[model samples]
Target chain A: MSVTLINLFAVPNGKEDEFVKLWEAIKVDITKQPGFISGKFHKSLKPDSRFNFINVAVWENEEIYWKAFEKSAAPMKEKLHQMGVEMTPALFNVLFEY
Target chain B: MSVTLINLFAVPNGKEDEFVKLWEAIKVDITKQPGFISGKFHKSLKPDSRFNFINVAVWENEEIYWKAFEKSAAPMKEKLHQMGVEMTPALFNVLFEY
Candidate 1:
């Protein structure tokens, strides 16, 4: 089973666009990792709430995700925080098969 | 770039577990897609609201994702719904990477 991660975030009011821009800046480097399939970023349609942004990723497994997290996510995580982004990421191991 | 998809669902009453169970049931078949990596699913910590479930998936791209959707997701989607899973899956093409 492939494990997918969903991270919910609050983009500190007006800083949402900046958060997206920053992600745009570093995307290429992150995609270079092995076992990375692809990922998408989404913001809540209703912008009135503080919980506005979401980041999702597909990887080969925990190993690949952790490796990429060290080399890619660490710096970006810091940058996002500096830009006022707050989030909680939770992981789910695939236990279901259709 | 990679695209990750997060689907938030309002699991009717106690059906959250069933929803997750159903997803688990079909996850393996879904991962067979060519561009597949891995994915995870998470539910809200506060389950007071009916909006208590989340499904996350990472794919190779829109093309691969769509292919998987056609071959694997259609049936699982129906099963999920039959088990009372209601969700909105929005995708954001990768706009950032670090």
Candidate 2:
């Protein structure tokens, strides 16, 4: 089944711009990967929200999602870490919709 | 602008079904509220994910979202708490999409 990757990022207050720039750079490469369906990068309205940035992306399936992640996004972890942006990512399936 | 409500649910192990049941009950009323747009309930693929369930819902705007929440979903919070389900909900705007 197709999987949705929900990645929540805890970006330090002053690092929001840096985080967005890095994400834009990563997006350029990841979007071209196999099985990538669509994606939306969201910024929380409240500055103090625990996870200030959230990415909701869809992949064809779990295998392709992980493969693409390893190839394109995994290498960018060091830079994200340097920016003090922590990420909590997980794959999910749609349980219900309306 | 339209806002997305991303509510992450940390449901205790073994309470998945009960959590979902409560969510469905809330959904029926909330979906009928004014300004409701769309919603998707997602279940994490990994059993050990920190947030087992996530609800991504769109509303006409933040004001409408809060209004609907106060009218329909707020009352159910006690039940959710009793079920050992913790929620972290935040409103977000789409910064980028592809």
DockQ of each: 0.14, 0.94
* A7-93: candidate 1 lDDT, tens digit per residue: 777788788778777767666776788878777667654565445777667677777777878887788888877887877775554
Give, for candidate 1 chain B, the lowest lDDT window spanning 10 residues.
Answer: B89-98
lDDT (tens digit, per residue) of candidate 2 on B25-92? 88899889999999999999987999989999999999999998888776788888888889999999
Error of 1 at B13 (Å): 15
Clashing residue pairs for model 2: none
Q: What TM value does the first chain of each candidate achieve?
A: 0.85, 0.96
Name the top TM-score candidate: 2
Model 1 chain A: weakest 10-residue lDDT segment is A89-98
Residue-level lDDT for B14 in candidate 2:
94
In candidate 2, which residue ranges exceed 4 Å CA deviation?
Answer: none
